[model samples]
Target: MARELRGHDLQCAIAQAAAVIGDWWSLLIVREVTRGHHRFEELLAELGISRKVLAERLRHLTDHQVLERRPYQTGPERHEYVLTGTGRALAPVLISMQDWADRWLLADGSLTGTAEPDSAEAARVHALRGTPVPAPLLLPATLPPGDGRAPGAASRPLDVVADARATVLFAYPATGVPAPLPPSWGSLPGAVGCTLENRLFRDAEPSLTAEGVAVHGVSTQRPDEQETFAAGEGLTFPLLSDMDAQFAAALRLPTFRAGQTLRLKRLILVVDASRVIRDVIYPVLDIPAAVEEAGRMAMKVVEGP
Candidate 1:
């Protein structure tokens, strides 16, 4: 049996807000739509909401004028639920929810400029805080490419010097093909935001390369995983795989063990023609701004001191 939305008989503005979008399912539906998950199937797959509950919430939202039903297909008559202007105004409400939850629900340093975590992310964050690189200041030792083919390699063990005037080596933990996420992954702190950060850098590569600053995405994921991600994501920059931990050992890079594998903490290195570290951006908190800042720093190194 479908449960009816409870009626609220209050005159306060807050009550009115609750009347329209009080339920958890409604808010989640809106959040998914805002992220471009417009179709019914997309929302169902992403949210894991039951069909009956989803249909009920959609009807409620449409009735309240929070969302409008628009036809997308003609022959069989398919429709999509999109936010009305009134619904669009509720975005801040969701953002505020994330801010509040991150502050109170997560541990110190757990949010990492993103949302709160579940068990997997909690473990990752805990591991990250516990491990510290012995040497923070020094150039990482040069290491050979795990395979002959990297993201943008002309050849194996990509010659950092021959690649560009300077290279922005953006090191990340790992990348993979989308799969069934672990049960607690949705609650993982900064997990979604990390992917957003990678996309931001990938989009900025053309400009970075034009300015004589080559970009290379580095991760502990194997060569094949990096290749699949780079190709699928339309990334033009090379992606270096340090699966064996040889590169991390060479530089004593900060790392955390997720399972038996040690993953690189998020860090960006500006390496000049001499293979010397020119600048380092550690613990990247902001995505777009980080790439912009890296671009500014890269331009400086390319122009010479």
Candidate 2:
């Protein structure tokens, strides 16, 4: 019979591994870093982690060579934590844990859109399905002109990138504005908070603009209908229409079935002047908070490469 080791000092590999990352928060921090929440403020906001605890765990991981702190700002001395090679190697372990949770803990898919899934997440999804993960998706050089209104106009293809500003495209399903929602709209999978979400984005426009990020709302609604809603709400930003789903096809944006109508999932894409997608916010359950998140990401991009 084999003897059991003790005190996180066991001779076995699993015991040593547990000693390093057994804490729930420790592994979650790694997961967050893997998901690109590198900045201290970003991690704090996204993880809801207290400063003291986060600091301790980050120090622990840094000491153990799991993460390397890189300086991103100098005047105030700001830093971002990046996963070291050793840290990245643990991705499979996390992926396996996620797969187990997906099968048993999250069978109902309650965690579908809590965070933007990066390439590692994509790999995990494929792994769960026993398939090879596809390569990272590349954004198109430029967006096609899609049907929409520019604040009190009819449906037409609006040139998305002609202005050369970093744009936040907040896409939703049909909104309950300018027209009464269809009877079962709320019951649809991704349509519950469609209007409220857009309202949140609109409210955050001032803050986003302060950061030099232009905010635009998007949906499958006709240009005329969007125009009415924008005018009624006194929205300062234009809402783009993709009624034909042409833009959807170009980006292969995710969607959910809403009876006969396919509704765009709640997605926020931070697109830069170069027409490159810089950041993505998905599964936006908390609409108002998502605007703040988008702002942070846009600023991060503006900060550097």
Candidate 3:
């Protein structure tokens, strides 16, 4: 639905804020920009907004200097349009909205029951004691709080280790657990593996191409983590299985400091041709930093005799 402009005075803060964001559609537009989405057509597809509304909003934002555009390609078909500095600055707002939605809006919810977590203390105590609360702790299911891991528990352990060489090994943990590193992943190779992804497929493919090398990221969407690489557009590598998240836990990746669900922390690895370690970067919020460092290491690995 098109948003109504509600205001009488320009001096009013609420009215001014509304004038800027003003509608559900505009706010969503800003969100699309922050998620590394730039091209007008791409944003249109992602937001699914009508052309009339999108064109109007884009014009409005451009007028307010909230976004700046640049050309990407040209010829019989000239393609251009990108988010400028102002548009890039909207990252926090989008991130905040995402965080809020994660809390109030359910990623996946059923008619189980709607209620906030009962006890924050209950959550911590179970974690601190190395005990696993039943699925009902977060999920409303069979009760009986106890260690989620039991002796002779039948489960595959995906083992990952970043050695001193900055290389990482992905193996089944049943064999052995690798030793700890020097307390930093700065030494590992630059690589990013995306789990099965429906949304950011294009975003994850750049990690393999020479041009995509620095901004490089690989997706592991396949069940077997099969490897694939297209020269430019599609993903260049296999995706981490999204099935059970065994690959994630093997790396001992932690998604949030809160010790929440079994979400694997996003990671970047840099591997040598011989596949020796160089540097590893985890918990990267700034993609440029992570990718650049990996790129630097990759170049060094190539240059070394």
lDDT of each residue in 264-288, candidate 3, tens digit only = 2344555443333345544344445
In Å, residue 139's CA in model 1 sits off its true spot by: 16
1 against 2, candidate with superior lDDT? 2
Report the C-alpha lDDT of model 1 over 1-305, residue by residue, as the tens digit: 22343455455667667767888899888876654466888889979989999998999999988889999998999998877877766655664564344345543534332322343333333343222222221222222235444545442354323357887877776654532333444454433354666788878878877888888777667665665566677666666766654345434344544434445667667777666667766556666787889888889989986
Stronger candidate by lDDT (2 vs 3): 2
Q: Please give the clash total of every predicted structure, in order.
A: 3, 0, 27
Which 10 consecutive positions of candidate 1 have the poorest summed lDDT?
132-141
Q: Evaluated with TM-score, which candidate comes out highest? A: 2
Error of 3 at 279 (Å): 18
- lDDT against the true structure, each candidate: 0.61, 0.63, 0.39
**Best-matching candidate per lDDT:** 2
> How does candidate 3 score on lDDT?
0.39
On TM-score, who's better, 1 or 3? 1
- Alpha carbon deviation, residue 163, candidate 2 (Å): 2.3
- Give the least accurate 10-residue stretch of model 2, judged by summed lDDT: 130-139
How well does candidate 2 score on lDDT at residue 121?
36
lDDT of 1: 0.61
C-alpha root-mean-square deviation, candidate 1: 19.1
